[model samples]
Target: MTDFDLPEEFDEENIVSKTSIKRDMHKLQALGKRLTELKPNQLEKVPMSETLRKAIDESQRITQREATRRHMQYIGKLMRAEDAEAIQNAVDLFDASSKAFAQALHSLERWRDRLIEGGNETLSEYIHDNPNADIQHLRQLVRNAKKDLKNEKNTGASKKLFRYLRTIDDMDNETTP
Candidate 1:
């Protein structure tokens, strides 16, 4: 049949644009890069075909820039035949359960700010929640943070306070079942 010939089985709506295909390829490539960055154990947790897994493993060994790029493209090509969403979900789940550094950092900062702003009331509440915390140390940090507030140049005290809060937070997480 000619290019314009009528075909009852053909649906124009099912056709994907070139841009869309390129976008998907780029997304798969980016995902492949993330897979390459994962540790061996973490890589194992991701659901992927054996061929795709082998491609990712090979990618890790290629240190040369251009070669690594080409190998990553190959990995991306291989991923086209695998369940990308399942693989992505596995990676995301692992990441969410990990340290979640940014979320934890923001939380610690908020606590530090509240401790400084909320005065003794907040500090008392914090101590109540974390009974094992060194009250004297926590109090000293708050006091130092308050002192540092007057001088913007001195951020050391607030940083120390953040660290102390993070330590307590981490310990609590570890103790929790």
Candidate 2:
């Protein structure tokens, strides 16, 4: 038989080749590196085996480059024995949520800047977008923020505006299905 030919019992589709195994190990190591970069709270959301978690924690503590690389390889080995798919899904979800949060924060910042710079026109547009928003409170905060900017104060009003935007964001999240 040729080198490419398989035995009757060996299903090519079901059998993992050496190259595929190596590729999968590299993918797992990449995921492990991503997990190690996460903050403690963010890492908590990703479901992982206890051993894998310990390995990741150890990897984080290691300062030496070669040692960290070896530890990451060990993590990849442990990952090979666990449910890599599920772990990957959890990490993807976390990444998506964080990205959404960043987008929302940027949107809020844009709105705040518009309120301070664009004056009545931008305020009207904002009110049109958020009908349930407290017009009086928003106007007050915007006025204070603009005044603080003009007078070169500590910009406490800007911080208050940010907090108000965050509350609105929280309310919107709660109301969404």
Candidate 3:
């Protein structure tokens, strides 16, 4: 057909440029890399599909550079089918710096210290507040933490105690809504 008789041009808004597509691919890859960097427990808190989780877990075992790169590309591919924003929000929850996160940490630390100092009294109080908590496990951690405090050594008991408290807090958060 002649130029004057040609059909109208396609809508520009509907077209995705190659540059934006590549940029998004790279962004997803970067997010996947962040996922791989997270600790196992932290990763568990993130909402992701089983297949994507398996790919990420497998990526950790890949030591060679080329293999890791290929696996990451696969992860980026998988990420395209997932809700990137939700995953990012879940991952962000594990990080520090925000006032809420700091407050939660301080609260857990206070509970740990109270359990160590007040012995059974504090244990009973905590159990009353967190009925769903593993009482026996928390009791054991408190005992170990107290022993560690007396010895003035960093044997990780205190850390374990803090972690246990945080776990209970996370559980409560999940159950409330």
TM-score to true structure, per model: 0.51, 0.52, 0.58
Best by lDDT: 3
lDDT of 1 at 152: 58
Q: Global lDDT of each model?
A: 0.82, 0.82, 0.87
Candidate 1 matches the true fold with a TM-score of 0.51
Residue 144 displacement (Å), model 3:
22
Model 2 lDDT vs. the true structure? Answer: 0.82
lDDT of 1 by residue, 1-177 (tens): 898897889898899999999999999999888888888967766777888888887876789999988898898899889889877765664465645545667778988999988878899998998877999999998988888887655869988998889889867754642
Give each prediction's root-mean-square deviation over alpha carbons: 7.0, 7.1, 6.9
Model 3 is weakest, by summed lDDT over 10 consecutive residues, at 3-12
Give the alpha carbon lDDT tens digit for every residue of 1-177 in model 3.
786573568665688999999999999999999999999977877788999999999998899999999999999999999899888876666768656577778888899888989967779999999987998898899889889989998899999989989989999766652
TM value for model 3: 0.58
In candidate 2, what are the lDDT values of residues 99-120, reduced to their tens digit? 6556777889988888898879
In model 3, what are the clashing residue pairs, if there are any? none
- Once fitted onto the true fold, the runs of candidate 3 whose alpha carbons sit more than 4 angstroms away are 1-9, 97-168, 173-177
